[model samples]
Target chain A: MNEILKFFVNQDRMLGRNERNLMYTLKYNLKDSRAIADNKLFAKRIFKKNKLPIAKTLGVIRKKEDIESFDWSKLPESFVLKPNKGYAGGGIIVVYGEDKLHSKEGNRVWVKQNGVKIYQSDLEKHIIDILDNKYSLGGTKDKAFFEERLKLLKEFKLLTYKGIPDVRVIVFNKIPVMAMMRLPTVASSGKANITIGAIGVGIDIGSGVTTGGVYFNKPIEIHPDTKSKIVGFRVPYWDQILEISTKAQIASGLGLAGVDIALCRDHGPTILEINARPGLGIQIANNDSLKERLERVRKLKFKSIKHSIKLAKDLFGGEIEEEIEEITGKTVIGRYVNMNVEVRKKNLTVLAKVDTGADSTSIDSSLAREFGLLNSFDEFMEYYKTQKHESKNIESYHLESILDFANYRGIARVNNGNGTSIRPRFEVTIKIGNVKKKTIVNVIGREELKFQCIIGERDLNDFLVDVEKKI
Target chain B: MESFIQTAFVSNPTLFYYLLLIPVISSIIAMGRNVVGVKSYGFQTPMLIVFAFLNGSGGIEGSLFLIFVYLISFFLKTYTKSFNLHYLPRIAVIVSLISVIFLIYFMFFFKLVNISSISPIEMVIYISISEIFITSMFKSTGNKVAFLMFFNTLILSILAYIVVLFIPQWFLLRYPEIDILFIFITIAFSRWKHLRFNEMIRFRSVINDMDKE
Candidate 1:
């Protein structure tokens, strides 16, 4: 702890809470925040005045009378309804074309991107709730506005699941400091909110390609549902995204601002919103401290927006990949390698296949029996079968004790050519050359397979695959 | 000059109470502003200063009456939904209601307290406290307003009471010019941009993240 404190003390570039408040009080005027923070309409007007590309506003409903007289049919097939003073992603409804499905009362239904059908009355009630400030930051009365729903760019559609993704860029002194692309997930319910389980991928400011990703604060490489690689996703129109974010920051007159930008299929990059006090989840996504970046650009003067963007890309970009590589200390292995496998106090040298497609490592059950691991498995299975017949509510500790007696870690579901079945998992230390790692491997009946063990990608993080290397 | 100071302090020691009131109020406002980031409109400081003076003169009983007014006004403002009243009219109602409550309390408990007569200054202080309460209620929710108003008044009142009771009257009388030091204190507080003590805990992650880098 003292070392950590010393490290922070030595980091002169890090911005603390005191410095943030001082910056706001000294550099930002309170009146300027009113133009962007209090009401979204005023912010849109400012964006329009500055000639920044923003989502076209369809209408603003300030009162119940406005909602009653408003023509709903005139709205586009797909649009977004949001509260003007809403914070985070609260009180936002995204409609994705009209559903042909019959409503309960046979009225017209609007289909959400998630496939939920909404009646016209439901939308009206939502609009009324917005007008009543149900989602406002402080419960002040707010206006409900309809905005053109930005079509997700083709590049992001594959990465996101049933939601539109947006990029959040933190700009200080008109220079982009750090940025994270928020991808909506099934868990986040089609809203790009990290707190609610959306994936936040760090973008390389220099290259605009995703360098890393985090889901629920844990580093992850693939989208949970799509199982597609999240890193190295080259964002389309990266320069335009930065330019619009910086322009929004300057237009809002906030010395430090979070600019949210989304790519529209037809309109290109559009400004979504400007946040005066953005959350700190971007730090977790980027695996970097914002304070250091903010302080680095504190005194630098930008001759133009293009110059500032270039300066930002030069200063804070391209280091995330190197930092990750240094931290993991990973080495490359091949598709087939000779390794010494140890299980239940016995070590056997065997040839193993490296398969990145598999989620977990698997070991042949015959090989396990040869090493005396099946004896404990039989003993545990006897106890488990007896307990299963006696009662359905088995204590977790008792189950853990059974696994401990059997020398197995836990159970996992394995899929092979035959079918999928549950198998007992055991802890195995595989030493490939001089590198040794203890990983959990499932014991399966793999008599027809050539290799006795197959190492999966989860255990392969410390080793990169050399596809052409022959063992 | 020394003789004049001695005579002035000896003749009217209560004047020192009013002089000390400025720092007490300014310190409270500055603490609230720096620590909590709450903004006060034009008259909050003057009203707090007046309340501090009243508390200094009338002691514990005056502090109790101020608290009673604050609580009653806060409750009335929160519970009375029928009067979705505008700003000025709502303040007028609250002020009148506080005055009525004070009148009833005075009529009943005048004998228990030693300070029986109400001065014009005291009347202004009561009205100002009521106005501040109403204005704060307008700006924030009931619980926050109640907590801030209650604590601000209680702290300033206790401080004023201590200064009145413990500080030697002769010290103030001899060095009346020492009161000017409050001006410098206020300026110093206004210019202080250091992190509040609580902010250190809030930003401890940034501090710890330094080690990771």
Candidate 2:
């Protein structure tokens, strides 16, 4: 934690709350209000004017008279109805196709993407609600508009629960700083809102491939419902997506903006909305802070949107992969490696099995006791109890620091040959094939088991596993 | 002009004293909003001034009334989960419930406590407190946030009250035109794009880094 603080201090890359406010006050002009707030319709007009690809606007019902005079038959079979000033994903209705039985009543009924039937009257009432500004940011009167319902790309069909998934790209000074793909879930009620339980999968800004996913603010690998892997899912047309987002930022004229894009199976990626004050949830999704990214690009000059897009890709793209390689070096190891494991302040050389199946490394409890880690664990527990009594609860970060001192890191329920039992994890230093690293290893009652230690994939990321080679 | 100022100050010293808090309270709200990243309604300043004035006028009873109103409104908002009524109507119902509670308190408890010093202005202030409470309840997303906002507002009002009460009346009287300086100060505050004091601590690492660089 101190190192992270020192790193941020040394880098001077952390953007504070005041910096954000000052950036908005100094960089974002008052005239840019239309580009930033309650101006999705205005933003759409700007997109149309700039010849940017966007969902076609069938019609806009600004007032009651417009709603009455609007011809529902002229609308597309599948379309989206949304309020221009609607904040987040509120006041959005996605229609899949026109219901044939209700079409006899002259385009009065429609089928929702989630298979719910909606009548024309229900839509009109929703439009009335939109006009009432029920879903608007400030509850000001709003305009309801019909837009082309972009078909979900095949790659995202299995990943998204029911609603359309959209990618949010945070563009700062015409450069794309960060991007996250928001997937709708049943909990979010078909809306890609992180606060409402939509999955926020962080996309590699450079490569446009998903690096990680966070659901309900917790790191997750797969869709909770669909069970499809979210990480490493390469977003199609990455460069084009970045290009369009940059164009939207340039067109919007807001120095800081969030450009939302959705991929249409036929039309490719289309700009959905450009938010002036985009949310900070993308930070958690990417497991990276926005301050460093914003600070990196805030001062740079860009001749064109294309140039900026390329720069963003070059600078931020494939960072995770590079970081892995830098930390691990180009070392390769066999499936089984003879390693000197240090625990309880004692060292023992043991033949450790390298298993990718385990999420973490594990060590035998007897070996852990021999190293005096078990005694340290008891001391740590006493300290933790006193701290908890004093502070009511220890912060996760502080708890981590305490664990670090105690040489105990985590607790996990491990399934062994006998049964599943809870085990305490201890921090151990291991030297395998000349590469020495410190990692947390779960201490289990593995006295009955053959191998005293098992090194998992997490510890093995730095080394390529060669099953046939003997080390 | 001096005589006129003295007469005006003498006529209503409390109002004059509390009026000076307007700019101070406004600056506090502005700084608080910038630090917390929450939007401040236009009425928040006036609400604080009124709260401070009422507390000054009726003392403990006035503060108790405000606290009771806020608690009732917060509880009503939290417990009534399925009340899918419209925003205006929902606020109206909560306000009505608060009014009833106040009425009951005045009718039964007021006689027993015999705190007859409560002025008509204090009553009006108590009523206005409900409006601000309801508005805040509506604006905030959760009960905890609503309570926090209320607490922040309360703390600021109390601070303003302290400033108004403790500051020498003679100093204010002699420097009557100092109020104009407050307006200019407010304008400067509005244009202040610098990092807030809290932000300095929040981004201390960056500041420390800049210092080293």
Candidate 3:
């Protein structure tokens, strides 16, 4: 009941879909400006005219006859085929490279990111589908275009699942309001739409370091597929991303727009597309309200895009959080100490190891059982014992049933010296000194270890771990 | 006697009553969007549909006619989508099919009723409205959403029709001063900046997250 009361305090600061259309899109985006943003071909031309970096368009197929007459051999090893008016990253095909095993000379076969082989006839059929308005926004007749695919950056290779990641910056009134880096996952089929299960990592405007991430509308600390840390990685070319996004918004004549930019290995940041009616999922990604940020800069004027970018960084930036942290001094804790943790509505003082090297917290399996945190896991294990399911075969059935129980967050893959192991994660509330935080902790068999619980770097944000202090 | 004829409109004031309801209709549409959070086609579409209801076949039949037109156009669009024709030609075919359906309905079905009650201009307005509905429906993201918006517009138009019919014509004719109150109503809507009713539920997660911080 108290939670319900707190929700209404910030209700007015959140923007809904209806209010976004009624206030921002309808008022700021004129018909001609929206048309420019809607058509990718025209928007790319505008970006090129303004000297912004964008992928080069090789050819456009407007009709079925164009498909038959087009030269397939002229295409490079890697290219992207997309509808000119596709929305939400729909109807896009990416060719990673040529199939060395299947292709000979003139009849070269290409391989998709998912390892599907694409022949010349398959490409022709796809072009015809695009021309027939299969992937176009509003189901209108659209043209199919071949574009140069940007090479993925080295830092992002392990972070992304099967495709290149892109940064989406929302530029409103010449100010880059908020930005998020979208990484495609295997579940999303390599598309960066958050609704389709891609990961959205929030970035700090003042600093380029990623602050947090949201996958499927829930805050996540690690990538589900790659098991790599999602937060704390600094985005490359932050200033250039903001500059190109703002310039693209101005060139398209849209007062409020979202510019999707990809970081290429050779070219730096390149514009992917501009959206007139951007989605509201960025708010969930950043755990911030767009209405508040938008309203803060609504009436302000800027002399230039650079000035506005600076203003945005100063006003809605990570420095504000650091300032608050400075005022409230962090608590000092030793490497090994006894911490108070709340379990099943009771306070239990447990010996915990403060380790800053680990990214997530983990508790011993026996300690978790004593605290009643393993009720659901124990039930699943009991069921597994009866079925005699092997460890490798438990992937499908174990996760589905365990996820149905309360407090079971998800699965976590831990890489150690021996090998990789999968563990079930649980949400627990722990108090270290004066700070109480609700964190996700993985359950592992730590009977041989000295301490029962290990506090990781994630839960040690408000604490200074003194290695030499004797507990 | 000419001066008396000019001032005599005050005594028999049917025209003044209708002219006064125009602002009333505009106010209803504005309030419906700003306060009640009902999105119809647009400001003009619903207003024109209301006028068509008042001037043509009473409110019920006019609404029924609109539903019939939308249903025909929606199904015809689905049927003809496979032809792979150009956009304009496909719309032309859908409109042509709709026209034939209208011709058959008017020629055979309404033979018993007084068809002369509806003016030729009103018939043209109704037909043009069908085209507008079809275009707007195609512009939506999906068929389900388009149908939902169409249903909302129909309901709002019917509500406006009821409001127009129930207001005492004699009272409006006598007190033309009451129409000035609608100006203040419009101003109130223009100044509305609070969260709408639908927004409370749509941003529930955002609100909770903010509270957590």
Candidate 4:
């Protein structure tokens, strides 16, 4: 299939119009890729303008003098030091949790990629390589920057090594057409780009939802390090995230573009940078091709950017998740609790739970007196024979209520022959993980059952129980 | 990397096999570069040299196989000359037919073919060089072109052979990052276009002619 796909892709006729567009001269519109190429500071400028959140830049260290005069003390404890014009993820040092490399006799220190470290010595030798502009645009001399390291939200800590979470939005004509949430992996050495082992989670365009993520070119449902389920997540500020990304398409002047957005605590979303020839991995992550989606979007010229955004939402929004599943032909295993049951007369140890949120624990009326606890004779018979009929038994079984607190309030007067006639609350010792907790579980006999415990908010706070985890 | 550093000196047979493929892919990408200006096939000439070195005949038996390939390609190229096809097609028909001819020739005339008989695919690879040569026919103009191209390729092949033979693991480590053409790659290719060596060498006679005039 791959060989066949490659063959068709290279075929002139088989290629689409968007692909044909790729062969032509890049456009001279707003957010032009060349402009982005000419200036790195434009990304910073855009972030600052919209009140979008971004990391605080300590200094743009250019030349030896800038490096010398810049207060090294102004550098935040555990800040991100990086090359300003340096290529992607290159010339960056992240010292997490008060990191200062030790020299002989431990003098208090400041370090750059140069000045120390032989690994960086190769980088300096490679600086000649970078200055020769082997890695830069036209081999021009470069500048570097120092900025505060970002605090990753709780969702990303275990999944990323040293890298912060960043979202790549493919904005076409001032509308976000596609997106991928890239998380750093150990192999990426804490960088979010997936080429080096970071995971790319496909986001559902219709809903600001995440589907199963991928790593090492294979689709995965969980983070390898954190063991967190990798799908159905609400990316923060859904509409605003899309709005800012769309706004960037107007800013960058590149008609076909990729906008990288990073989150800040104070600022909502900041533009990381703009990419002209954004990677096809976004297509892979989003589970759709840019050619097809962009084709739909590229149609219908709009008078204003607002109409274009509305059109984008109409055309590409809902179909994103479905298209992703179609392209990959795989099911996203969501973090859901499920079970299979054999419905019959069986000794099924129906695991039960209790919630103090309920006023009383109800049992099958047949066990009322069998466990040596007396109940009014008339009330027990009436409750078991006809459950829907509600009657007050203040003199008899006033303490116990037969009301089913499962969904909408209802009555369940269930009984089996083996159940105790006296419905006495049994002290159930349910073991969950390494922790043991005690609960009052009513031994109920019924035709069938779903969940044994309601586990309302009241009793849940004590054991810190996860209903998904069971013995 | 430690293991790669250790394997670097060994020159294993598998390394040669994998190394042989680099040229094949690079060849395809080189075609892409010339046609599309994608710059995907950076360092193409070196890659082709590497390919040829790894695939070339090594010893006396290997030489005899080479002779068989030459004999087969020569006959097919001649036999297919009357066909209406272009140079490449002519070469292709000849190359395909050469495989059968070599197999037949070996069966009738010699026991020198390896494993008591040359494998069909091996014969195909040997004959395929005729197609490469046919492409080269359009590569340049004037007398001594073929000879110049041939010798240049030969030297490159030898250098590629030495590199592949001595530092097989070095190429393996570095090879995956090949075919990456970024803004950086564009920057590099642009530089390569302005190269002075190829310009001076290719137009030496023209310069001499102009000087004489």
Ranked by TM-score, the better of candidates 1 and 2 is 2
Report the lDDT tens digits of candidate 4 across residue range B57-130.
43234435544554455455446555535433455576667666766877777755445444444444556655
- Candidate 1 RMSD to the real structure: 10.0
Q: After superposition, how far is residue A377 of candidate 4 from its true place, in Å?
A: 21
- As for DockQ, the candidate ahead, 2 or 3, is 3
What's the TM for model 1?
0.56
Provide the TM-score of the second chain in candidate 1: 0.71
Q: Write the per-residue lDDT of candidate 3 for residues B47-121, one digit (tens) a residue.
A: 888888877887777877788888888888789876766555677788888878878877997876678886565
lDDT of 1 by residue, A330-365 (tens): 454568988798866688898899998898888877
CAPRI accuracy category, model 1: incorrect
Off by over 4 Å in 3: A1-43, A49-51, A60-146, A149-166, A172-175, A181-240, A246-257, A263-268, A275-281, A294-314, A319-471, B1-20, B102-128, B168-184, B187-194, B208-212
Task: Tell me the spans in candidate 1 whose CA falls farther than 4 Å from its real position.
Answer: A1-38, A46-58, A62-68, A71-168, A178-244, A250-254, A260-272, A275-292, A299-314, A317-360, A363-428, A431-471, B1-24, B35-180, B208-213
lDDT of 2 by residue, B1-213 (tens): 888988998898867866765665565566555644433444454455445465545435555666777788778866654664555566678777777877887788877665566666666566656766766565444455567667666655555565556555677766767777767766776665454554444444334434432
> How should the candidates be ordered by lDDT, best one leading?
3, 2, 1, 4
Q: Which model, 1 or 4, shows the larger DockQ? A: 1
Model 1 chain A, TM-score vs. native = 0.67
TM-score of chain A of 4: 0.63
- Compare candidates 1 and 4 on TM-score and give the better one: 1
* Weakest ten-residue segment in model 3 chain B by summed lDDT: B1-10
Give per-model TM-scores. 0.56, 0.65, 0.59, 0.50
Cα deviation of A18 in candidate 2 (Å)? 3.1
Top candidate on lDDT is 3
Q: After superposing candidate 2, which stretches have Cα over 4 Å from the reference? A: A1-12, A28-37, A72-79, A94-125, A157-161, A185-187, A195-199, A213-229, A281-301, A324-471, B1-7, B36-46, B49-213
Worst lDDT run of 10 residues, candidate 3 chain A, spans A320-329
Query: Which numbered prediction scores highest in DockQ against the true structure?
Result: 3
